[model samples]
Target: MNNIADRYLLHAAFPLSMDNESKSTTEMICIANKKSVQEQQLLQALESSEQRYEIATKITNDGLWEWNLNSNQINYSSRWKSMLGCSNQEIKNSPVEWFARVHQADIEKLRRNLSACGQGDVSQFEMEYSLLHQDGNYRVMSCKCMAIRGTEGKIDRLVGCQTDITRHKQTEARLNYDINYDRLTRLPNRQLFIKNLQELSQIESSCLFGVLCLDLDRFKYINHNFGHQTGDCLLVKIVQKLKSCLRSGDLLARIGGDEFAILLAGFERADYPAEIASQIQQKFSAPIEVENRSILITTSIGIAPLTNINDLEHQESSYSLIEALQNAEIAMHQAKNKGKACSVVFESAAYLQSIAKFKSENELRAAIELEQFELHYQPIIKLADRQLVGFEALVRWQHPDKGMVAPGDFIPLAESTGLIIPIGWWVLRSACAQMVLWQQDRPKSKLAFISVNIAGKQFSQPYAGDIIAQILTETGLDPRCLKLEITESEIIENVNVVLSTAEKLKKLGVQLSMDDFGTGYSSLSYLHCLPVDTLKIDRSFVENIESNIHELELVKTIIKLAQVFNLDVVAEGIEREQQCDRLLELQCEYGQGYLFSKPLSLAEANNLLESVNN
Candidate 1:
């Protein structure tokens, strides 16, 4: 038959009633009808497939496009046209039209990527780029493009899809902003400042760039006096003030806390940093008002000029931005020492001092290694009977080069360098071992206990209880006769960890004393919560108890608070006989100071103990 309609028919009269010629014609009709049904089914399946493809493109938010290589013609789907705020009729179906609409800056990259995909070197082309929209604004698009090869093994046509990704682009920009900026002050943070410093220091090697470190002096006082919210407000105002002092290209960043950093990217003279530091000093001369309160604050500035390194390897090593930052910090300390609101330039001597400090740190490590550290015992007397009840174990370092290095000089370095963990363990082990010896030597006399001062860093150590227990086991010291004097601030910081450790210490039968109680802002919560046996009055209060009424009252209040908590009180630094009488009158149970005798060496302590026993 000529067509499907002629090839088949759906119905015919009964075959038996028809003649031979008529029956053949009727059979042909039936075949034609069956073929027609199959043709209809195939057409329906093709329509279904086209509909599914349309749905997929819509669901994926894809804007599809096709190009004919031979004709140099282009076709765009409705979605593709809508994506760029263009009507189908507005945008011509030409390759030139599409290519021209790509962001001017992105066109060359788009061409390169498209060429790569068309060469069959890549399976597909993918990139995020902006496209000029009909609204005269750029819309970000994720373009996925590919080249389809013909049977002749050549590029037949180009195909691609575009997805609107403006929202994603915006999100990425926001994340980038958050990463580089400080939330509190809206200034470049440490990372961003450091990044810029690295770039400048590397490129402008011959140029002098002043790296200034700015720290608000007595900023902690603001936090304690006005609250952190007020402190935050002060920081914002401080940034504004510093930003005013900077040039457009100069960077001012809030590294953290009340600390800020400034980079003077270019300076005509070497003394410009010192000049800038002076200007800053003058700028902060006036008191700043924050949250309805006029807060008096002074800033200390340290300046270090970047050193030049020509070699690439040395650029990365010898002249690191971090080294410049450290130098600035060293200068800042000198400024602080000079006075608040003062500015100091980095001196060569500061570098030498840092070298000395590093040497001291190494010597500390050596001291710990060579067992050059010693424990001196100061007597803790029972004021009621003048009987020696306990001794405070103080760590002393016998440095080979520096002679006797005081703990005040080295303990801070250990804490800063995280050497306190190992050093602290040694102190604990040494104290425990000494206590064991004292107990063994004086079997008749009742040596109640020895108190070892634990640093804030040491108390923060994980598994503090385990360390203490191990030392006790090894030294054979009775846990009952060992008291750990920890600062009250340590008890309040990190409540969960402190609580767990405190509980473990209690279980281990170790007495806990809150050391330097009145010096820190004491919270009643700590006094009520911690398993403390005693409170040692800070020497600052006890040193001037008679002279300063406020200090005297503070001491009395502390004693009363300890009494309410059922904790014993020990007044430290009691040198005068009058101070001892005053402590007795105040019902203070214990006193430790030079009056009882200075911290004695091990042999001297043993002799003193023998004398007391006799």
Candidate 2:
């Protein structure tokens, strides 16, 4: 107050006539009061600003930090220390403290960024890095900082804000994992497998690499018999077994349902892929127990090798990663065709065959639409009387361009593509109608039956019995005049379903014959259980019966077994008189082969029937 009054009095030229002491005292009181008011206002404004800054820091949850470049000291806000789970007293106001809290891997990068800002190369910098927390875990943090310059235009200090992004980072990682991994097996999915293949293709390595495509055999049946829940558990167990067969560096992925693939890299030996496939198959030999049910399964595998990525690229300019996978898949299908539970190595020949098969499948579909198929009937002879009692219907493809295509050329293809279903129905209806026509033409003559071959898939259809009955009603053919022949393998593989189908057909007065018996699973155990009226000896045994005594004995045993079951025997492929005589001597009831007559066209068959009646 004294200095304020003295300065005020010295600056002010008040009236000299008044008492100097009294005027000076009054003026000093006024100046002192005004100075006190100004000082109080300034302090209030400073307090308000500090309160606002604290609220902002709290609202934003941003930890503030200031670094004095000259003194190499850092000032950390209380909030900053608390962000790392530390108290203000626990942290020191020093750059060393901040640097020590940074992750070791991120420390060098942080220093380099800070150096750039200090050198005035950047006005500010933003970086996301890992920071060590007080809980001994690293937290992802996003830091934004700006350099403050001094009067000499040199960096004097740095001020920054750090935000904890640990949750955000975890969410990002989880999303990435979900996209690339299978949910059921936790293995890499198809997308990740393709990505890995692409990455491998980019590497300039001479080491050999390959892919293995595996498919579970009869998995659909398992799914149908057991519920999908059990099937899923089975698949998981299968993954565990497959993993045990893989090398450490190999990658296994579940590409699709019941289909898996393995990527083998850096292997020098060409046979290594086959060895792994064998091991995997061996592991499946033991039955897997799932949900208290012991399930047996096998896999078909295909292997495609990549000897040199560069060479492959050079060979096909349009080469793609998907094509590599497709090639392996094609080989896997080939293995399935050869018989499941085996592995096939991809080759140029197999690729070409796949292409051909694709074309042929399309052609077959078109042919079915255009009705380019016809039935040829082969006469079935009663060996004792040498009389024609029935005819077996065979399918022939009357190709528009290829003249006549034999069943051997396309039957397997038809079976694989499920074309056999429609084609099989067509044969059945045609054969039955033709038999009705023959019966109408010669009402007095007896035509025992017309035998039609039914495919395994067609027979397995639930509505097969109903469909056959409908066809019979439509054609006005006696069910007793139509005999259905199913292969032995088809019957044995699905005995329960086949038995049901057989009972249904039997109710319709249709006879069942086991076609190609003795060629596959000649299980005498199921023979008596089947309600079959006849057993047709396979052509292989009949073909060698003349010269092969072992074949003759097997034929004898088959005939005796048929007799024991009270089932009629039909010998197929009797190409020679000796074979026919031998079959008759064995008491085989019926026979059909070139020795009688080849499969005949409709007009030829009509002529033959008339000749037999005459």
Candidate 3:
């Protein structure tokens, strides 16, 4: 090993410019000495090369290291030790001390990679791992290592470089958090929930998982009345409570505003799931005091147990948690329909039945669009005059298969699906057309108005006013022949729109009436402002008109109140002669019910109108 020179290849050389002079100076030195002039010159050149290499390394903050595997020793570069918040003299220079500072969790992985390097296996010498700083904080380091093998094909020495990457690692972690979590609720969002669910399903062996679909009932009412800030505060409170109800292993997710979902497992019996759901439902039975106001809240829950992840067969290629959640949603709606503050379980057969009902609705909609619906007008006669003065337009669905379905069966469905808009429009047009025809046949008959009921959604549409005006104009019937009836409950929700539309209809010369009075939300302020021409006392009040003297007096009081407002009074559902006679005796201007005739078709109503004049 005497006078060992650098044994390396250098094919190209360029002049180094120093002091404004191009000199053929040596950029690198090679030490070669073997009793030859050339070898001795290389020895001096190699010695000078060391100073330039050290300068470049110091400028870039790059620490260099050499490990001698044969000696079982590891050496750390000065810069590497300095980057760890330490100086060269303050820390040991061996791999043992290096691993000592490494986080305990990452030590095994670092050891595994280092062992591969010792065996001459292909390994990325440069890597990143966390190290404990002098102050006990963690710092990330980027390491580069290259193997130096021996003549016997065994490792001899290894050299590497290390750089600090703590800032970069911190930035990456912050971005990952912002991407995966919800900002407002501070919970794992839909993205993170599905990811966690996927990971959990792979490891769990219980073969049982349940998805609970939780929707806040009347959450919209809170938002509407108290404003969105209060609504958000209430939602935060709800999220905390729902999170508390679940076990540590269970996952709670805020899937949407006013809606949450929970995945539960580790249950011994189906009753366990039911009991948990019941507990959540009952928790909100007490009022939540917010902003000095007591606000009552409740939840509708639908739960579906997943026997296999693929129990939901209708889902697309990547079977998702949302599909199971959707099944839970259908169950929740069923709970709501049965009445809120209850939990409903998923029944596959019953769910199929609901799907079938949905299909029937599509068919019913087609029947409505194709003019397959018919109007049945129930006569409202004067008990004393025995004359038909008006007819209540009852809508009937003439299904191709199920003929003449009554309003009692399909009307509620129509209202729920919002198909009532088109259906109500058809009813108004057809009823008005019939009234015009009836007047044509009996010129001397008492003038009768066709009363049509409007749905709440229909009244809310922006074009409702224009539609009514167009229908009356097209039918060539006096606007007086059409009486537009709206429920009291609907007017309370949208009073301004109701008042504007009612005034517009009145200006067009059509009459307005409030239907089903007193059974709904009791708000009398709308009654004064709604441009109503008649107040049809609901059928329930009329049912006990004779027996219940209180109801009898109430009916007389309604008529007396109407007289003061210059509004006519019509008593609905007058069945018995005594009820009709009582209404007439109370001086009620109009009476309608089964006693006159069950709702008749347009033809029967026309004939009844003919008899009025004869």
Candidate 2 ranges with C-alpha deviation above 4 Å: 1-46, 66-75, 118-120, 146-158, 174-193, 210-264, 267-303, 313-344, 354-406, 417-419, 426-451, 460-463, 474-614
Q: Which candidate has the top score in lDDT?
A: 2
lDDT order of candidates, best first? 2, 1, 3
Q: Write the per-residue lDDT of candidate 2 for residues 1-614, one digit (tens) a residue.
A: 33434444444434345464655777878866766776666557666877997787777788998888887888888888888899989999878888898998899999999999988889999998887889999889999999998767778989999988999999999999999998889999999999888777767777777889999999999989998999999999999999998889999999989999998888889888888999998999899999999999999999887776766755542354457788889999889989899999999887997799999999999999999999899999998888999999999999999989999999999998899999999989989998999999988665699999999898889888889999999999999999899998999888888888889999989999999888885568788889999999999999889899999999999999999889989999989999998888888989999999999999999998888889
**What local lDDT does model 3 show for residue 270?**
56
Question: lDDT per residue, candidate 1, 252-310, as tens digits?
Answer: 88887778888886567867878888888888999899988888899888888754434
Residue pairs with colliding backbones in model 3 are 5-31, 5-32, 6-31, 29-45, 29-46, 30-42, 30-46, 31-42, 31-43, 32-39
- Predict model 1's lDDT versus the native: 0.82
Worst 10 residues of 3 by lDDT: 6-15
Between candidates 1 and 2, which one is better according to TM-score?
A: 2
Q: Which 10-residue span in candidate 2 carries the lowest summed lDDT?
A: 1-10
**Model 2, residue pairs in steric clash:** none
